[model samples]
Structures are given as C-alpha cells and as structure tokens.
Target chain A: MKGYLGIDVGSVSTNLVFLDEEGRVREAIYLRTRGQPINALQEGLRQLAGRLPENTGILGVGATGSGRFLAGIIAGADVVKNEITSHAVAASTLVPGVQTILEIGGQDSKIIILRNGVVTDFAMNTVCAAGTGSFLDQQAARLNIPIEEFGQLALQSTAPVRIAGRCAVFAESDMIHKQQMGYSLPDILAGLCEALVRNYLNNVGKGKEILPPVVFQGGVAANAGMRRAFEQALGWKVYVPPHYDVMGAVGAALLAREKMAGGGSTRFRGFGVADTNFKAGGFTCENCPNLCEVVEITCEGEAVARWGDRCGRWSGSLGYQDEEIRNAV
Target chain B: MKVTFPHMGHMWICLSAMLEYLGVNVVVPPPTSKRTLTLGARHAPEFACLPLKLNLGNFMEAAEQGADTILMAGGCGPCRFGYYAQVEHAILEDLGYNYRLVVLEPPRKHIGELLSKIKYITGHNSWREVIKGIYFGYQKARMVDDLEKQAHFLRPREVQRGSTDRAFKRALQEVIAARDPQDLPKVREKVRRIMGAVAVKPRPVLRVGIVGEIFTLLEPFVNYDLERKLGYLGVETDRSIYLSEWINDHLFLGLVRGQRSRKEACRAAAPYLNHFVGGHGQETVGSAVIYARQGYDGVIQLLPFTCMPEIVAHSVLPGISNELGIPVLSITVDEQSGEAGLVTRLEAFVDLLARRKGVVVQ
Candidate 1:
C-alpha cells in the first residue's frame, strides 16, 4: 500500500493522518502533546506504523499546526503549511464548497472564508484564547464532569443561563458566580457554550461574511453544545465533518499528496523514525542583546536541526547537507 | 549634555548626525532588543501601547549610559502620544532616574519655542549653523528614506537571500558616516552602487501597502520586522509614512518643497472616514484606498495593541477591503506576540494573496 502521511503537532493535541493514493484517508491517530511534541509525534508515528500492513510506503509527508516546523524536521515532511491553510484545504475537500470554516483547536481558534473553493479571507483569534477547546476542557474539569460527557450534559439543558464570555478569566469567574447561584449543571454548561460561541463570532469571525455550507472542525467540534450554539447564532445549519478532530492532519495529508503529484521522491525518514532516540534542548545565545532562545534537536545524539534564532547565527551555523535541514531552514 | 532619543527605523542616523554636527554630545541607546522591551514593559502602564513602553526602555538604557537629557517629539491630538513624554518622564522620576526631557513640539506658531529648545540642546551653535544642521539632517533623512525604498523594491527580487538586507546595511552605514554636507552626493552614489550590486531575478512580484500608527510602521522591533518578513515571502511593501515625509508635513517643509501633503490622504479617506480620528488613523484608511486604486495585491494594517486611532481605522478597514476588492489584514503587536504565531499569520496572509492572484506558492 502507498499513501502520503500528514502530521499536525498542535499545542494541546498531535494528530496524524495517512491518505492513500486516491486521496482517501487510510489511518488517523490523535494523542495529547502534553508539552512534549517530540514524544507525541513519535508515539503517533509508532501507532500508525503498527496499524499499517507490511511493506506500506509513504510517498510524501506534510506538517501543520503551531509545532509544524518541529514536526516537519522530525517527520521529514515534504511540505510544511500553516494551520489556517491546512484547515481550509481539509474543509473544502471534505465538505465541497465549504464557504466558511470555523475551527476551534486546543489553544487557538480561526475563521476561514472561502469563495468559489479558494481561500478568500481568514482570521485567527488575536491576543486571546478564551473560547478554544482547552477552555472547555478546563471548565469541564472544574465542574467534575468527564470531558467526553460535557457536550451530552449541555444537550440536556432546559434553560441555558447566560454567562460572560469576553475574556477567559472573566468567563471563569462568571461561571463560578453562576455555579454559586445554584444554577443546574446542564443549564450552566449550555450557557458556557453559548457564551463561547458569541465570543468566537465577535472576535475571530468579525467582519467575515459567513454564508452557509459552513464547516466546523477541530477538537472543539466534537462538542455538540458548541455546534448547537453556533447553529443558533448563525441561524443556519453547521456541518461537522467526519474527521473534524484531525482535519489539520487531513489537510496536511492532502497537501503532501498534491506535492508528490509533481513526480519526486519523498523525503520521509520512514516509520522507523519512531524508534529513533530524539532529544531536544534550548540555550540562550548571549552574544547579542537579542538573546534569542535557540532550540536544537538531536537524533541518535547527533545535531539534526537548530532554529528560533532571529539573527540566524545558530540556525545557519549547522550544516545543511541533510535535505531535512535544508527544507526546515 | 549627553542627548539620547528613541529609535524609529533609521531616523536615528539623521538625528545623531544633526546633533553631532552641532557639536552636541549624543548617546544612541543600544539597539532595541528583548531586554529593552522587558525593561520597558516591566515598568510601563499595562494598557499603554508598545511605543510608550519602548520609549521608556530607551530612556532607561540611555540613563545607564550617562545620558543626562532625552530628546523626544511631541504632538497634540486625540492620540495618547500627546501624553507619552509626560508619562515617561514621571515614570523615570519615580524610578529615581535623573534626566531632563526636552520635547520638540510641532511648531505651528511656536517656532520661537522650538528654536529655543533646539538651541539649548545644541548648547551654543549660531542660528545660521543651526539652520544648516537642520537642512543637512533633513537631506540625510530623505537619502535614508530613498535607500530604504530601494531595499524594499529589491528585497523580493534579489537572487540571493539576505543579499539585499546586507547591502542595505552597508549603504546605511555609509550614509551615517557621510556627515559632511559636501560628502552627501558621494554617499548617494555609493548607496546606489551598493544596492545595484544585489542581483535581482526580475520576476513579477505582489505589491503590499503598509499603513497604520507611525511607531508601529517605523519600528521593526515592535512589529516583528514585518517588512523583512514580507520580503522573504516575495512581496514588495510600500510604507505609508516615512520620517522625512512626517517632518515635511509637520515642519512646514512640505509647503516649501511643494510636495504631496497629508491633505491628499485626508481627501482620499473622506469617502469612508470623514473626520480626523487622531494619529495616523485617517492616513491608514487613505493609504488602503490609494493602494487599491493602484491595483495592489493587498494592504496590511500594522498597529500597536490598544492604539486608539488605529483601532478606529481597523474598524473601518473591512468596509474598504470589501468595497475596493483588495484584501486587508490587521495585525496588532504587543509584548505577548509570539514569533511563531506572527509568522503563521503572515504566511497565511501571503498564501491568501497568492491564491487570489492565481500564483501557486509552495
């Protein structure tokens, strides 16, 4: 079997997807990053390798999300794209003619507007992460409800109470106040969902013309309450794609396939990279006043990649003989 | 008196040259860095824009270097910048830093006061020599702006990465070194030769207009080196404000030179924003319209977080974007902005622009 591999190493969750030659998803894996992207990426690749048949070939690899550059170097991706473009590509492919895409991931949320199957405009939440998936996770834990059951509980709400949703801190305090007022758990949960939806629409979705065939994806898309809240706010039906949680990965896989169509060899280091010992460390360069924090990644105790220096002193110091280092730089 | 001023792009070159030519002891604060921002942000009011914080940081760093006086520009408008000097001075006094702040306000009818301040800073330079120094400094600013314009044009087209930037640095150093008025033309020739040495690929490039608050537009440290980033993404950037232009418009030089005035921008913005909203807000709106009329690929609004004027402009920009059929992106920079996040947004914006132009970007 031959396919392209995509890895999206986001802040909270790392997802991997494999797409076969026909651009169909073959495997999907999601795991918690837990502040250690390297570990999560290797674990995902290992799991994916185990699930694949013997002699499976990865024709190309792509990486996306906040930790994309790190994932690209580790996975030897042929293409590295930002999450916005990746998500747009995924939504447009999965839900054809998706005019508007609302993606709420672990740490950030973004609104992508498409026209005639092309990305026309897009915006990501700026200076605030109040209404993302991580906030919901924290709220669920605070209420002593399993995160998986949070959406179901909200669905059972009879009268959803309104909560402040301007800032995450303010929202949390507002929720505490409502809880102390003896509001039912389900009602409060549903209210929190509505508040977040309002915030998302006002902030990230500001000035965006959201015509329907709207596709909602990302980790928070699994929350039925959020979906319902968005539908009610827009007064239109919102479609959550089947692989909504891993759409970034899916987009990366599709991008990898597109790149491979040019007839070139894949730069993939292979699934065997799962067994490689990868170590990452950082050091502050005091040579200048910038004091850039540089991160270096080592594979089998040899320096494989270095980045994060604004002046390029450390990033350019390493040899670029390796294709991975060349592309990463 | 050892004089220091905040950095705003290459304007310092002209300022330091003018002061040094008048035999004034000038101290240039260390190049803006994270430490400078951290020092400034630590003491600055949390809600103040990034420029004020950076200005505070500049003064502190200069104070450590034995600077006894700070040179700052002043303005009067609805913008918070009118109060920055006073606020920064009070903050420094609270921190027990002994320094005198000499602000040069716009000389509408107060030309005498402006001259007296300049005379005090220059210590004992004759009036004739002072005027000569001022003219020389203005010319130097124009030259620097010209050099920067060329760099922006060549950055995207340069065959080798970093070639244009390296050449720009060399040319700028030459401009700074050519202090004597007679040596100006020699510096100009050298700048042209140096910039010309950068081989260009001669490819069609996407043009982007940058307009917003003066500080954010002029200071790369606050805006995450936006011009360079756009250059790397193969986009040519045209900035709406330059030091020489600001000086020309405010110092009555524009009338003397018969140059294009801010009134033109105001007229262009009249369709969308009829009234002055303060700072460069009107100019930001006008520049987007100008760029759109010129058939540019996109317009990017760079504003410091909480900038009152640009915030007003930001609200009105989407309408201009939709009406003009040009993509507009508003980016706010503050202490909390992450480089990775900025890069991602920039790449996505460039991707959007490229796709709209039917150009395939890897």
Candidate 2:
C-alpha cells in the first residue's frame, strides 16, 4: 500500500494521519503535546508506523498547525500550510459544499467562510485563548470529570445555567459560582458550552455570514456539548466529519497529494526518524541589542535546523531559509 | 545640550540630520528592541498605547546615554496622543531622568510656542539657517520615505530574497551621511537607480494597503515590521501615512509641492466617516476605500491597544470591507503580541487572497 503522511503538531495535541493512495485515512494517531512537540511527534510517528500494514509505501508528507515549521523540518514535509488553510481544505474536501468551518483547537479558534468551494473570508482568535479546547479540558479537570465524558453530562441538562464566557479566568470563577448556587453539574456544563459558543460567535465568527452546511472540526468537535450549543445558537445542523480531531492532518495529507500530483518525489525523511535521537536547544544571541533567542534542533548531535533570529544570521546559517518554507506553503 | 528623539521607522535619520545641520549635538536612541519594550512598559501606564510606552523607553535609553534634552512632537486633537508629551515627561521626571522636553506643538495654534521650542533647540542658528536646516531635513525625510516606498514596491518582485531590504538599508545610510542639501537630489536619483536595479522577477504581485493610527503605521517595531513581512509574503504594500507626509500635513511644509493633502483623504472618507475622529481615523477609512477602488487585493489595519480613534475606525472597517468587497484584517498590538500569532494571521490572509484571486494553483 502506498500512502501520504500528514502531521499536525498543535499547541495541545500532535495528530498524525496516513492517507492511502486514494486519499482515504488508513491510520490516525493522536497524542498530547505535553509542552514538548518533538517528543509528541516522535511518539505519534512511532504509533503510526506500528499501525500501518507491512510494506506500506509512504509517498509524501505534509505538516500544519502552529508547530508546522518544526514538524516540516523534522518530518521532511513536501507541503507545509497554515492551520486555517489546512482546516478549510479538509472540511471542504469531506463535506463537498462546506460553507462555514468552526475550528476550536487547544489554543486557537477560527472561522473559515467558504463560497463555491473557495475560501472567501476567515478569522482567528486574537491574543486570547479563551473558550478553546484547552479551556474546556481545564474545566473538565476542575470538575473531576474526564474530558471525554464532559459532553455527555451536558446532554443530560434539563435547565442550563448562564455562565460568563468572555474571558477564561472569569468564566472559571463564574462556573464555580454556579456550582456554589447548587446548579446541577449537567446544567452548568451545558451552560458553559453555550457560553463558549456565544463567545465564539461574537468574536471569531463576528460579521461572518455563516450560512448553511456549517462544519465544526478540531479537537473541540469531539465535545457533544459544544456541538449542541452550536446548533442551538446558530439554528443550523452542524456536521462533524468522522475524523474531526485529525482534520488538520487530513488536510495536510490532501495538500501533499496535490503538491506531488505533478509526479515528483517527496522529501519524506522516512519513519526511521521516529527512533533517531533528536535534541532541541535555544540560546540568546547577545551579539546585538535585540538579543534574539535562537532555537536549534539537532539530530544525532549534528545541528539540523536553527531559527527565531530577527536578522536571520543564526537562522540562515543552517541554510534552512524561510524562502523554502514559504515556497512549500 | 544633547538632543534626543523617539524612533519612528526612519524618522530618526531625518531628525538627527536636521539637528546636526543646526549645529546641535544629537543622541540617537538605540534601535527599538525587546528590552526597549520591556523598559517602556514597566514605566508607562498600564493602559497607555504601545507608542507611548515605546516613547518612554526611548527617553530612558537616551537619558542613560547622556541625553539631557528630549525633542517630542505635540498636537491638539481628540486623540489621547495630544497629551502623550506631557505624560511621557511626567513619567521620565518620576523615573529621576532630569531631561528637558522641548515639544514642538502644532504651528497652526501654537506658532509662538513652536518657534520658541525650535529656537531653544537650535541655539544660536539664525532664522535663515534654521529654515534652511528644516528644509534640508524635510528633503531627507521625503527621500527616505521615497526610498522606503520604492523598497516596498521592489520587495515582492525582487529576484533574490532580502535584496530589497539590503539596498534599502544601504540607501538609508547614504541619505543619513549626506551633508549638503544640494547632494540630496543626487542621493535621491541614486536611490531610485538602486531600487530600480534590484533585479525584479516581473511576477504579478498582490497589493495591500495599510491603514491605521499614524504611529503604528510609521513605526515598524510597534506593528512588527508589517510592511516587510507582507512584502516577503509576495504582497506589495502602500501605507496610509509616512513621516514626511505627516510632517507636511502638520507643519508649514504643507506648501511643499507633491505632498498629498489630508483634505483629499477626508473627502474620500466622507461617506463612511464625515468628521475627523482624530489620529487618522477618517484617513484609515478613506485609504481603505481608495485601495479597494484602486483594485488592491486587501487592506490591513494596525492599531495600538487602547487607541480610541482606531477602535472606532476598526468598527467602521467591516462595513467598508463588505460594501467594497475587500478583505480587512485589523491587528491590535500591545506589549503581549506574539510574532507567531501575527504571522499565522498574515499567512492565512494571504492564502485567502490567493485563493480568491485564483493565484494559488493548489
């Protein structure tokens, strides 16, 4: 079997997916980033390698999400794209006429408005990570409930309480207050989901003409409570694709397929990279007043990538110029 | 008296050159950096906009370098910036920096005050020499702005990455080192030739108009070098305001030919914003409309956090964007803005533009 590999190393979770030659997801691996993207990616790749059948031929690789540049260099991605493009592509591909895509990941939430299979407008949360998957996870942990069961609890609510959701810290305090007021756990959870949906609509989805065929993806889509809240608020049937959590990976794999459609070889570093010893370190460049903190990634004690310098001195030293990254995107 | 001023993109070059021509000792603040922002944010009011914080940082750094006199521009308007000079001075005095602030207020309403401030800074220079120095500085400002504008034009088309920035930096040095006013025209011609010779690939480039508060539009540090970033993303940018344009609009230099009149912008913005809400609010709306009508791909608005006028402008931007069928991305920057977040939005915005225009094959 021949397939394309897609890796999405986001803030909260790193997801890996393998798309067969026909673009069907053959294998998917999801792992917690745990504040270490490299380790999470390696673990994911290891799991994916074990899951794939013997003699599986990897044709291409793609990377997305915030840690895309890091993932690209490590995975040797043939296509590197931003999360918005990746999500939109995946949503549209799966749900042919997906007009609206609501993606709430760990640290970011975005709304992509598409028309006639092309993206028209989009918006991402600005400097605020409130009402995202991570916030939900924190609330679920505080309530002593597993994140997977948080949504099911919300569905049992008979009377949903209103919780403030403008800011995450305030929202937590509001939830605690509601709990103190003796509101049922289900009601409070449902209300929290509704509040998050309201905030998402007012902020990220502000001024966006969200018509029918709304698709909600990202890790947050796994929450039935959020899905219900979105339906109640938007009054539209929201579709969650089968692989909502790994949609970014799916989109990346699709893009990789398109990039390699012209019949060119991919830059896949091979699955052996999972076992390769890699080290990441950073140093503050004091050569100038700016004092840029440059990060370097090494494989087998040899530096492979360097970045984060403003003047491109240290970053350019490794010959992994941004021009190549930009071209890939 | 060692004179010092805040950095606004390349305005430092123009100001330092003008002061040097007037036979005044000048202390240029070091280029804005993370330390500058940290120092500024620590001393400045928590709610003050990014520009004010940066100005405070510039003063503190300049004071440490033995600068005893600070040159700051003053204005009278609805914008909070009119009181920035006073607030910055108070903050510096509280920080124990015994620096004298010579604020040149708008010449229209404070002609006597402006002249005295200039006279104090210029010392024994005759009125003729002062006027000549001012004109010389104005020339340099125009040349510098022209070079920057040319660089923006060349950045998206340059065959070699970073070549346009390289030429721009070298050209700025030549403009700064220029001593004689007569040599400015020669430098201007040379700059044109240098920018023209940057080896362009002749590829069609997306044009983006930048509109927002003047400080954010002029200062690269506050907005994170937005123009350079967009240029590198294969988009050409035309900003609403430049230092030279601001100088022309506010100073007696309005008589300078070729300087765009604020009246035109006000006229263009009349439909969306009839009156000046201050701090380039009307101009922001007008520039967006102008860019859209000019067949530009999109408009980006840069606003400093807590800026009153720009917040109003931002609210009105969506209407214009929808009516005009152009995409507008309003980015707010404060002390906490991360570069990664900005880049992601920019890349997504560029991707949207590319898809809309059918430029991206995939």
Candidate 3:
C-alpha cells in the first residue's frame, strides 16, 4: 500500500495527515505548536509513524502553513503551498459545493469565499489574534477550565453575556466585568464564543459575501461552541468536516496526491528525515536593496535547501558547484 | 535652520507647526501636481508601488526646493511601509541627491521615546516646550483632519463641473491661513456655507474607499492623486486611515500581538463600521459596508497593489460586495499602472454603479 503524507506547521499548532491513493484520510495527528514547531512536528510525525501500517510506503509528502517553507525543508516535502490554496483545496474537496471557508487556527484566521470550487475571495489575519484559537486558550486558562471542556461549558450556558469582542484587552476587561456581574462560567464561555465569532465576522468576514455551504475548519472548528455560535450568528448551518483539525495537512496531502498522481516518484526524502542531522541558518543577502534574508538548510555540512531569497540569488548561487563558482568568479 | 518633510495632504499643517515651535523654518513641498507624478514615475522602478515612486519623487522635489533633511518613521512588519525608508534612501542615492534621512523607529513602548526624538529633530532642548509643541501640533492635525473630512463631503457640491480643483485650492488656502485650531471651526463653517450655496446637480458618481499603506493613499504623486482622479469622474471618495492611525498603531497598540492590535482597529473604526471583517483590511471593508449601507452607489478599494494585508482584504471584498449587493472595483496601484487605463476603469465602474442604481449619466 502506498500513502501520501502532509504536514502543516503553524505558529500555534502543528498537524500531520496521511491519505491513501483513493484520497481517503488514513490517519491524522494534531498537536499544539507552543512556540516550538520543530518539536511539535517531530512528535506529530512519531505519532503518525506508529499509526501507519508497517508495509505501507510513503509515496509523497507536502507541507503547508505560514511556516510551510521551513516545514517543507524539514519534512523533505515534494510540494509546498500557501495556506489559502491548501485550505481552499481541502474545503472544496470535502464539501464539493463549499462556497465559503471560515478557517480560524491557533494564531491566525482566514476567510475564503469560493465560487464553483474556485477561490474568488479570501482574507487572512496574521497580525491580530482576537479571533484566533490562542485568544480562546488564554480565556480558557483565565476561567480555570480545560480547553477541551470549553465547548461543553459554552453549550451549557442559559444566557450568553455580551463581552466586547473588538479587541483582546477590551474582551479581557469585559470578561472580568461579566464575571463580576454574576454570570455563570458557561454563560461567559458562550458569550466569548459569540464574541469571537462576531469578531471573526466583522474583521475577516467583512465586505465579503459568505455563501453556503459554508465549511468551517482549522483547529478552532474542533470547538462545537464556535460552530454553534457561527451558525446562530450567520443564521445558517456551518459544516465541520470529520478531519477539521488537520484540514490544512489533509489539503496539502490531497494536493500532493493530485500532483504526484502520475507514475512519477515523489521528491520526498522518506521517513528517515527523522534521523537526518539538519541545521537551518539565515543570512541577509546584500545583492540589492531588497536585502532578502535567505535561510539555508545544511545536512551533514552539505547545503540541501535554500529559501527566502526573494530574487532567487542565493538559490542560484547554491545550485552551482565549486567549479561553477570558480568559473563565475 | 528649517527642516522640511515631504508633504502628504494636510500633513504639513501639523509638521510645520511642530517645526515652527522649534524655531526652524518649515519649507513644505509644493502641492502635488503633474510634475510631481512625472518626476516620480520617471525615476521609480517599474514594479514598485505608485506610492513609493511618488514619495521618492516628492523627496527629490523637496530636495530641489532647498530641503536638506527628511524625517520618516520606521515600521517592523510584513507591510511594505516598513521598508520604505531603506528603499527611498537607495533611490535618492542613485539619483545623486544629497540629504540626511533621520528615521524615527516607531516607539516600542512609551510615547516618551518618540517625544524625545521629536525634540531632537526640532532642536527643542526643553521638554516642557516639546510637550507643548506636540500637544499643539496634534490639535492642529486633528482640526485639519476634521476640515478635510467635511471637504470630502462638500468638494463635489461646492465645486462646479470640473471645479473640484478650484474648491480644493480655495479650501486649502483658507485652511493654511487659519490662525489656530480655534479658527478651524469657522473655516469649516465657511466651507460648508459655500457648499450649501452651490447648486446640487445629480450626477452619476462612484464612491471609492482608498485603503492601504498610508503613504500611498495620501501621497497624490504616488497614487497619481487616484482619489482626485476618481473624483474627477464624479466619484465620491472615503479614505479611513491617516498618519495619526499609523502612529497610534505602531507607537501604542503594537506592544501586544495576535488579536490585540486587530481589536484596536475594530474599536477605532466602530463609530464608522460596526463589525470586524478581519485584519486592518476590516477598515476598508467596514468603510465599504457603511458606504453601501448608506446608499453609496459603488465602492472602489485602492491599495498599493501587492500590499499583503490589502491583498488579504481584496480577496475578501468580492464576498463582501456579493453579500452586501454592492459593486466593488479593486485597483492595485503599482508604478506600472497607467493613468489613462485606470481612468477608463473608473469610468466603466461608475457607469456600472449608475446602471445598478438607476441613475442616468449625462
């Protein structure tokens, strides 16, 4: 049996997924990024390794997310794509009629509007965190509730309090004020869910027409409370696919599968990537005013991959052997 | 010695006032014109955004008019505005212009650092005087912005057909001549009174909201006075951001990352736009939502074209328009954009908006 592997290493979370040749998900692993993407990817791969059949050979590998470039190099991926394309691809594949995608991950959030399976419009919030999963994590910690139980608490609410969802500061103060006002934990949690959904709608969903069948994915989609809140706010049912948490990875896997569907072999370095001694380093290119900070990866003192060169100058330099370098000089 | 910065709309009124308090001569760059655009376009990279090219042109023009030093703010982010100083410096150097570029790294924590830098630039040794100058400068800028807002609503009415130039010239002259912040209300009232006196003609107009990098939107030479050009085609304009917001975003709220700054913009734009669409892109979407809700015929989103944040916003705008039932035309301004082609798009967009609104164009 042959399978494809996909990894998405984000600022807030890392995900790994495996898909069979039939585009069916065989196994998926989702883990918290916790500011250590390298460790998260390693742990996730370990978990995925245990689940795979011993005889199953990994056919191809793909990586996506904000840290896709780094993760791609680390995973020795055959293909790499941005979150927009990856998410859109996954959502469209799952819900063939998916017209809009509301994907809120750990640290960032995005809204993709699709028309006839094509991404017509999209927005991403990388700088702000008010609507992302980390905000909810902080609120969960503040409330002394486990993140896993947050959705259940939200579901238990009788009356959801209205907290300021405009910003995290105001939301914090507002959450405190609600607590002082004698709101139950469940009500507060529910209110937070509503407020976050409201913030997402206003910020990322602004000006864009969100059409149905709207597919909500990303790590945040794992929270049933958020799904309910979105449904209530938008006055429509929001679909959460079975593999919501690792949709980015699944999408990347799907893309890799599609790209490498032909008899051609994948450029993936294989599972032995775990044993490889690799070091990633960066240096600023002084070639032009662009001053691109090119990051290069060296495996056993041999340069294997170079990226972040906006002008491809560093990549071009690395491709040449010592003879080419001498001749050029 | 007088220190001058490149003029961006009513920016000079505040900067000049600040410079004046330091006993420095403030030589404001001449108002943006065809020459400014020509000069900027001639020297700027073909792929560079219109604003960058225009700002570089503005600096060159300012240097030619006897300015020796330029003060600019620094940013640290994915936004192209962060790299403006470095690129502008290189462009100026390549052009053989000699000038000192004093970049004020955005205040990471307290406003005190920024105040001290302002003091340093102005040569105001006294903190008390520097504080006074800053307070007064801020007051003047707020007042100017207030007048400018009124002018946006009034410009179409007060000016005759193709007379936006005359009305703006008159209003700017009156604004420049105002003695103080207190004098602004009277100036505004005068402008309003004049607008009321002019005959209101019903014309097909497309209202465009210019949002993106602050420099590109306000600096006419960069965007080729895109707003003015759109206005020339009988389009109403609404731009939600200014230098003040940029200052506040960098100097103040930027301390917290993730959702904190995102919420800050949403709070700021709440009076105008009641919801968050996401990112600072929400600012543009919020304004467009309000514009559409308030019966604006059509919406145009203007960005530096390749600006990541705005691109994110642009991606979502189609859905926004689709949902709101508003026709939105997005124009990305890079150096390569031709004025004639942009004008034609504006013409077509206006025509479409008019057709949608059942307004007949003459």
Winner by DockQ: 2
Q: Which structure among the candidates has the greatest TM-score?
A: 2
What candidate 1 gets wrong by more than 4 Å, as runs, is A319-329, B255-260
State chain A's TM-score for model 1: 0.97
A185-257: candidate 2 lDDT, tens digit per residue: 9999999999999999999998899998999999999999999999999999999999999999999999999
In candidate 3, residue A125 scores what lDDT?
57
Put down candidate 2 lDDT per residue, B1-362, tens digits, no spaces: 99999888889888888899999999999988888999999999999899899999988898889999989988787898888988999998887889898888888998998899889999999999999998888889988888988989889888887889889988888898899898887888887777777888778678899999988888887888899889988899999898888888888647777777677788889999998898889999988889999999999999999999998899999999999999999999999999998988998899889888878522
Candidate 3, residues A132-202: lDDT per residue as tens digits? 88888888898888889999889998889998999988999999998998989889889989999999898
By summed lDDT, the worst window of 10 consecutive residues in model 1 chain B runs over B252-261
User: What is candidate 3's TM-score against the reference?
Assistant: 0.53
Instruction: Point out the worst 10-residue segment of candidate 3 chain A by lDDT.
Output: A320-329
Retained native contacts per candidate, as fractions?
0.74, 0.68, 0.03
Better of 1 and 3 by DockQ: 1
- Model 3 lDDT tens row, B270-359: 554554432356677566666667676667677776667677667666665766777776676665555534543454465445445555
State TM-scores per candidate: 0.97, 0.98, 0.53
RMSD of each: 1.8, 1.5, 18.7
Error of 1 at B347 (Å): 0.7
Roughly what TM-score does model 1 have, to 2 decimal places? Answer: 0.97
In order, the Cα lDDT scores of the candidates are 0.89, 0.90, 0.70
TM-score of chain B of each: 0.97, 0.97, 0.78
